[model samples]
Target: MIRTRTQAFRLTLGTLSFFGATAFAQDSHLPEIQVRGPRDATIGTADSASEGAAERESFQSRPKLRPGDIVEAVPGVVATQHSGDGKANQYFLRGFNLDHGTDFAVSVDGMPVNMPTHGHGQGYADLNFLIPELVSGVRYRKGPYFAEGGDFSLAGSASLDYFSALPAPFVDITYGSNNFRRALAAGSRTVGDQTWLGAIEIEGNDGPWDVPENLKKANAVLRYSQGSPNRGFSITGMAYKSRWTSTDQVPERLIASGQLPRFGSLNPTDGGNTQRLSLSGKWFDKGPEGETTISAYAIDYQFDLFSDFTYFLNNPVNGDQFEQTDRRRVFGAQAARTMPTKFGALDGVLSFGAQWRGDRIGEVGLYNTENRERLSTVRNDKVQQDLYSVYGQQLVYFSDRLRGYAGLRGDMLRYDVQGREPVYGALNSGRGHDAIVSPKAGLAFTLTPQHELYLNAGTGFHSNDVRGATISTDPASGLPADRVPALVKGRGAEVGWRFQPNEDLTATVALWQLKLDSELVYVGDAGSTEPGRASSRRGVEATLRWKLDRAWRLELDGALSRARFRGLAPEGEGNYVDNAVERVFAAGVTYIDGPWTASLRLRYLGPRALDTQNTVRSRSTMLLNFGGRYAVNKHLTLGLDVFNIAGKKGNDIEYYYASCTGGEVVSGACNGGVNDRHVHPMEPRSARLSARWTF
Candidate 1:
């Protein structure tokens, strides 16, 4: 094992020296192009920012253990997994936990990735189908100030664009600790006037747990495209499938008492399986005065998850294991038009867009199970949910130094739920509809050629689960339950500034706040909607990037925030938002010279309150990772990645809740109050080595 940073650095240098002679002999010089303004000005609006074309190069040189980690490229976003790898990762950004993409929208190649009203969570986004090497660029926005962003985009949004063609064909194989193995093959070819690209990936891993994760996954993508984004058409198909055993969170008291190890689980049979198949198409046209874009997609998806959070708290006989299943087909389409326009003495642009989506779910249900055997059903339902939206925006340039933007959007949601089986003879079958209108405005002032100031305010919302919107009875108790509205509203505002002091340095700072009407969620475990109180969050973020030289770059990003429920609580009880992370920091350094490249990154997640009351808190965690690569010849290259290089002892996730075990009884009953901190510890230090052959 590599023990220290110095040793790792020296090792990397030594390896580069061994291959330097051969690498330099085959090196060729390339011409350079320089532009005068901000590198991202062309791709970003006043309220947004783009990662730029260099982002693809950065991704190629970095090391990531999972495909979802690519989101970390977005400043102030953090990704972590608690359960099986097959499930969507937990995301944190801008003072929101963003549980499984709840408040963050994600898309790839004009296709939406977040699933609404999912069995496990709302807005579940799984990126396991993505092939990282195929990504061409990433564009991100921090607030809901853009007219194009809709549901689940209150906090932020990210769009990933894939390359239509590859520079060359390549095959890569990787091996790592903990029985990790991966193989990938990708290439592109020109057929007449169209470009065709194909890629496939297969991977497996047995993580460091008493019960092996045994994760198996595969992904494939095929695409055909002609022309460019300004005028182009493309059709793509994607398929992904995965299965894994999970080590769910264990009580800290159990580990403290030597009853369970930090990496052990009370229920060893917990796991899940998931699959997604999709077909999508995109077309764009650029005319003398305007442009138009159209996109359409269809997807079939299924998920089955078995989790035992409280071993015997709810059901002593069955051990509290439960299953959540979702099977659905989704269809969606979007169209947009942009054109230059002027009013009186102002010069500007006008844009209009529309989106339509529908989800037909065959069965979304929850069940009681023991050792993966179903015992009793809680609620089984068929749901049909549809959403339609139309929006328009106008950008007016008052002068060379100032500009203004205004937008209006309206959305309508319809929900239908049919109960397949009732719990306790109580059935819930109903239909509901809701409509909302949101407005957005922004102002941008150019203080200098390289400095800009922006003020933005916007309104956004997330759709409630169809089952929650229509359910009239609680499946757990068979009691009358209040049905929630079909949609929840959110409003946000931000004041930010961007500065580019020189060609090598760029910095940005923003102060923002957001308020939510209510935190309503579909409790998949209970098969009902749980209404929460109104809440507010305020935060400040700062980001900096410096290219110290032609071969080295450094980046730093940090955010701090406070989150709370608005209503006053009873005396002695706090109103803190549970699990709302307050601080995050990330720093990285990258070096690239000739055929050698290296990167080192540090990430920190600060302590947070685990419940409404601040008595219980979590510990902060910090990690370091390193990656290095060397080109051996024109057709061959080698790479190494070290994760958690310091072997930090920390938890990937933590929660405060009640749980019971067979051996432990409290008050002559197997019920433990809400005092246990269930935790999933982080993985220990591990490494992966890879070889790639290019043709």
Candidate 2:
């Protein structure tokens, strides 16, 4: 295994080196595009009012503490962390917690980032490898109305694109409170008909915790490309590795009783390490016949994580610390074509696509551990999962004032599992396959050149973890286990309005609802599936953006939602869905004058029920952040960012669960662990200063 990984690394490096050397021999120049405000000008061009894009300018002036926070640019999305910076972020959108990106899809440069049947969680998306400086734009959509989206796109999706070329080469260095340090170098150059872009990043941080979350990271990207948006080909290579000590959420009672600090951890040995290497390429062509695109990718990924969420709840003497391991190789390919055609006397455009993905997991396991040392294996298995999809859509221009589209998509999933443990191996090993078909439709009416109304409806589905679909018996105990369906179905609909009264102002409002057949999900932390009730969610969202002259811009957005389980509930259990956020609001003001730029943003998260009974609720949180930058010269710039400007004392996340501290244990067992709120506190006020040199 070691030799194989080493060879793969060498091959990737050699390919990048060869491309870089070849591109340095020729020279050409291309002008760069001017980036605009926080939101893209998508009035008449948008398929739905809830879909929009954010340009590079929108990200550069924001006070973001992590790369995943870039997704927050979407109207109602929120990104927060409950563990170390190296772990995947927790996300919330449209009344869904979207734990580790389960129902929300995210991709970078056409390469999928979500991991299926992962060790930590299904659809685990870790953006720690992303270098924010290389991003060009983020295009986002809400609801399941697009035919091209598959898998985890039931709630929403976002696609991030990288700039094909940079106006100038640059280097950035930054230092902040809590021992945060970072450095990044990136550049792009055109040689003959091809362009080469490269970047490297290094960062370290010791968070303000009693355990001191020590984080170290290194990342690099290399790309070779030729052509424009209309016709082009490009290839990219990425490598990243990170390790960190985590400070997971702790029982709030401990802090209340002065037994532990708000930032203290019950187990200091909990941490994780991860590595990812990938190579991807894309080819595009446009002609009188149509426009076509083809893309393919291969990725190598590995992760090892140790966590102790319950402390001594499970094992009094050895503690509850355990480890999750995942190592896999992923391969995928996609092809699409769009063509203009005439349906009788009507003019329309037809788009069709096909996709294939396969995951070859060498080992995905759960093990009991003490002080990060493995004690005994609970379950160990190897899995192979493959997915195939095809979709087609037709957009018809019924008339100058009305346009509509209809689409159909089909997907098939197949998996094979092999248990490596001695006792549970035979009982858990199995093979399974499933298929699904979804329909999508949308209608838009142009009330005027500046106003539009839209109605969209779609069906979508997400696959369950293969282990959950094939498990016949419990690995830890000899109890029979019921298998969950390989795929869960969902339906959603939305009505929206978009108004662009003038070039300087744009506004949008949307009402949407979604229903899922079942919420049954695999619990990666426990190596088992948790049965869930069917659920429904409905929400309203609004966004407004106005340019108060060319130097100033104002943005405001908010969402209100309600989520509940369907049908009858248990006697004492209410219909409320735990942790389903009900309200979110954000506002920002940006100012740019001459060579100076500044922005201030406010974010609010409303309180929500912590359990089904609604007997206990969580506290609302609000925060303010500020950022400013000054151009020293054409080639130099300095910037400052301050987070939690109000010094708010609040939690990033809260959960109600049973856990025990050492003092609560007796005779090698926890006496019915106490059920209490566990919380991870928000970071205090802190600031960072950075300097960038452009050449």
Candidate 3:
């Protein structure tokens, strides 16, 4: 059959790759080629040993909305739902917030995802662009040694590595329900053993949300590698474009009628787009006493968005023309070597890097520009930072039961002001450079061959700009606006235990602590936009994993966090809202039988108090999601997935534009004087059925 030709092509490509590596063996002085793994160049390994096998397989079988769900399985990590699909959610680690998490670093194929201030000012890391099915592997590091400069990361980093190797040719396509669907295709062939790869993927989700809140995206990648364990060079290039909509939630009464989360939804048309490119290099050669390895990478990320935010009185109508963009390029080179020591293996890696960023942000007032009313310019201010850093670590193993590591880093940090646009800064002064040093430490011990325990402690520092930390500023200063927020230092600790009794199962438990010395915080249209120093949180986290005899498997994941303010009060868009303490809990369970997989998810949030004396209470609610899949044959599969199964009572944060109604004076009681507006609420129960085929 004509269709068989494509399958035959894939087989031939795989076969060629299997023999190509061996065919080039005649070159005795070939340069060694190593695809980059997680960039933990900060710490050296315990011993100089052969590198672990490179994993060329994607982490999961599929990545359409229902298939390759970027599942998080680890202790001390929680995913926060941000409306729409869980795919757009954020991850919290070690009691620290990853909404622009500086303490937590995240990169994909070495591309930075965090917004460098500016863009919508609502910019955080958006990891949904790449389908999990495209991922080569993921690296999770906690408690320091990860020097990600954009955001503060005292807790850890989640580095996503994309496929760097390519076979001759391949194609994968899938279709699903709820107007949900996706397609992926790629091919790589060697020109005399110099491999070149190209891939493209597209996905769309009609979503449980109604109307324009739906999401769609397209991604493409091209890569090349040469030399091998011998000599040569390699390069990779990728381009991605995505635009997603967020429909603000509406009252339950509207949703019950099946008209909300869409057109009937409170507010619709909340959306944005993103694009990025990255390159990496490696060269290794045998040395006199030890081996020497050199590596380098350059990454650039850019974001563009047009969002619609909920509004109140005195609110400009153009409802703040939302435009947030970031341009950052970082290049660094690292070298590491291993030498045998009397008591243990001696190893160390040294890395030096330079970071450059350009951000453009502007808010178009909903109010008429013809009205001669100058829309308040929050920040046309552009802040730039120059970063240079060096770090080294030593791994020592005294016995099979005992091993430890210690590392330190030095940084020469500097800053510059490009323009005097409206910006948030500490006190308005444009300080150029700030010097900070951070450190890290860790130890691992094996109680038995099957059990291991580890403790890791690390510290991180964030550079601060005195540009924007206030609300109203005097125009007479004529000084460049301080749009850049202040930076701070974070101290963190992680103690964990893991056991792998057999190949069938594994378990892990851990306790984490993070303390912020002047932790940084920011908000919209509030003030200078400089990070507020009055914020900090502490909590404990844990996780579990079990596989029951292949066909039947079950897993339970949950998180309990006690997060609140250390001691600080700040004003919000509404008087009833401020810097108040709050708690969030997200947990779920999954079961896989035969070709069918079912899962239940639950989210519990603690009671939240109003910022004002009115004392409005935000009640907690639970959401349930279930899905099942059955493979009818070799190339086709049927599936069903649903969200908010029980139709739980959705929650929202309210602000009073009206005054207090009854009760005692200053009671903040809404005795009918409920002058207010509602933000988005949670989604209600909705379902979709899908069918997929891969050839």
Candidate 4:
């Protein structure tokens, strides 16, 4: 068996090398052409009005205390974790608490990272599998004005690209407060016109919570490629696994009554384990007048999570702990072609694309548990979901200073669900199908080389869970329920402007609004879908970047928003959308000179309403961080990172809920009644020291 495994590995490597070499040989004879006007004013796509790019230089200088922090590079986005290091981070953007990436689409190396119809929640995106050192660049776009964006992109999208080759082989070791340790080894080599890159990472951390996170994580990546990102064929393989104990949110009454510490946990057994393995490839060809690109991927993913949100909210005897399990295989492919053309007095580029994705889920289950012991099953079933999309876009230049973009996309989705046991109230075996057509348009007017204005409008949608669309009874309450449509629609519009008065400064401002047809969503915790009223949101964002000198740079970004239900509430209820953020601000300064580099950043999250009545709210939070690096020699470097510089006492997340603790009832039934505040506190001040050696 060992010999056979070795032979298979060798064959895979040989095939990758053969294709890389062929691509290199074909491009080697092409003539070099230099023709440039101004850099592409549009960021990722022609219709994108609020898009930006973060290059390797910014990645290298930023302090990434956690893997998900990398996404903070995008303006007006904030990343925070409410559970453990191994779980997905909570994201907030554009006035919405994205809830683990529900409204934002994320992709890495051309492979979609967001999971639809997940056991935990819809559009669960876990960035823990990423290795910061491997990221080459990140391009972010806010709004659904681009045809290339599909599901979970109503609010925005981010694409993370990895480097095909490293500048040099390197080993890095880091140690920090709270018994944190990490090690990484990465290298790249060129052979016969092909570049092969490999990397491995191991990390462990025991956070500040009383339960001690005890997180362990491992990641590995392998790739072979030739040529640049614009025109190259690359094959990649990745593997990641992690396990950790979580300190879930605690009730405020428990701390106020001295029943538990602020960082204490009601159920110390709460934890999770996850794993992912993927094989993916991308091929692209660029010619004088056109470009063609294709990408394909296959992934195996598994997650097992145990959580106890309400101590005795539902079951006073056994406690309210439960387990969620998901195991699935995902396959997907995309192809696109672009060609430059001209009409009577117009110049333009026409593009056409198609995408297909399918998920085969073997087991998605929810079970009642106590102290990690399963007591009964709530629901268990198998799910199969398929999505297909086709789109066409045209970018026309009426003049050197004016451009217009128009596109249309059509998506078809099918869902199939099979119940494992009827005793658990699982949805009966059934199938559901839906289709949607989205129209997009935009205009960009360049008043001069340094000033521009843009107007965009688009429609988008997010798929509903299959179980929700077919279930006749709630798994937890066992009551008659209403089924939701297979898809929910959203419409949005934006107007923005960009100005660069000189080489030292750039600024952008945008105003946007979005309306959702329905707010219905599957509540994973309750094992049912919650019907909601339609809602509307409007917001403003401003960003500025300034180069103080050759060695210093500064950035500032801010956002403000308002969200409310479109219609009046039934009786005494309010129109406010619960948990919608109202304000956000971020600022950063960096200095790079000689052999030293340093950066400092500050982030703020404003208060939010915790309930539709607007009677309760959460407090705001602010944090500051600092990072510095110094070169000791030609092949060695030393670095330090400090987080929460002010040691602020603030919560990472806050919610309003009801629960019973220690067999005591606080003005309510033993099960649950009155609402109380629940919070997850931010970590105290901490620091990490690192040393790296390169060859």
- Model with the higher lDDT, candidate 2 or 4: 2
Model 3 residue 144 CA deviation (Å) reads: 2.9
Every candidate's lDDT: 0.76, 0.81, 0.45, 0.78
lDDT string for model 1 (532-650, tens) is 77889999988888889999988888999898988897686678877788999999899999899998988999999887897899899998989998999989999999999999998
Model 4 lDDT per residue over 351-387, tens place = 6789999999999888899888899887888999999
Better of 1 and 2 by TM-score: 2
Please state the error at residue 462 of candidate 2 in Å. 1.1
Once all C-alphas are superposed, what RMSD does model 4 give against the true structure? 8.3
Best by TM-score: 2
Candidate 4 is scored at a TM of 0.92
The TM-score of candidate 3 is 0.71
lDDT per residue for candidate 3 within 499-611, as digits (tens), equals 65654455555566666665444343231124544334545444434456655444444444443445544554222223232454545555555666656555554554433
Where does candidate 2 stray beyond 4 Å? Answer: 1-41, 520-531, 666-670
Residue runs of model 1 more than 4 Å from their true location after superposition: 1-45, 48-54, 424-426, 520-530, 570-573, 666-669, 672-674
Question: How many clashes (backbone N, Cα, C below 3 Å) per candidate?
Answer: 0, 0, 52, 0
Candidate 4, superposed: residue stretches over 4 Å from native: 1-46, 227-231, 424-427, 520-531, 665-671
* Model 1: per-residue Cα lDDT at residue 266: 86
- Positional deviation of 52 in candidate 4, in angstroms? 1.4
